[model samples]
Target: MDILYLMILCSASLAAVFLIIFIVNAKKGQFEDDESPAVRILFDSGEIKEKENNGNKKDEKEIGENNKIEEKSE
Candidate 1:
């Protein structure tokens, strides 16, 4: 029927629109750095560890100050 033809035309146009968007994104480098994102967690974890190490130093300093305060109070 004519309805089938209309449905086919609508689906084809929708597919074309999606394909164009995909092509534009691909050309604009949207998919170029796919590998970095996957490996980013590995590198990011090292940076987090470094930050945690730095934070620990501050915590130790605070603890030392607390001990000094306790000694003074006693």
Candidate 2:
């Protein structure tokens, strides 16, 4: 039927468009460093005591400051 033909054509056109976009992105090297993000995460030292972790960072900072204070007091 004509309706079936039209549906098939629409699906084929969509598939072609998606394939073309993927090919273009591939040519642009957009996926070349996909593992760099994972590697970078693995290499992090977790030493950046962020301030928004609900008082933990503040407590650590206070502890550090207290050590310096105690050092000065000594």
Candidate 3:
């Protein structure tokens, strides 16, 4: 009987801790973007790559180097 009471108290404390953590996260906007993340994986990476290739955008390294050179010139 004593062991049963101890187990109940332990379980209740663990439940309260988890509940507090969930409430804190919920209040902090952690759960706000739930829909976007689920849908984001459905987007086609191949389509994104095709768009990037069509744009002829400079690579990140070249862009960074160009910015550095421009800053030096100014």
Task: Please give each candidate's TM-score.
Answer: 0.61, 0.58, 0.57
Candidate 1 lDDT over residue span 1-74, tens digit each: 99999999999999999999999999998999878888876543546545666677567777677657756966
RMSD of 3: 12.2
Better of 1 and 3 by lDDT: 3
Model 2 ranges with Cα > 4 A deviation: 45-47, 50-74
| Tens digits of lDDT, candidate 2, 1-74 | 99999999999999999999999999999889878788887553425533334445456677778557756955
Please estimate how well model 3 matches the true structure, expressed as its whole-model Cα lDDT: 0.81
When summed lDDT is taken over every stretch of 10 residues in candidate 1, the lowest stretch is 41-50
| Clash count for each candidate, listed in order shown | 0, 0, 0
Candidate of highest TM-score = 1
In angstroms, how far off is 25's CA in candidate 3?
Answer: 0.4
Clashes of 1: 0
Error of 1 at 32 (Å): 0.5
RMSD over all Cα atoms, model 2 = 7.8
User: What local distance difference test score does each model get?
Assistant: 0.78, 0.74, 0.81
Candidate rank order under TM-score: 1, 2, 3
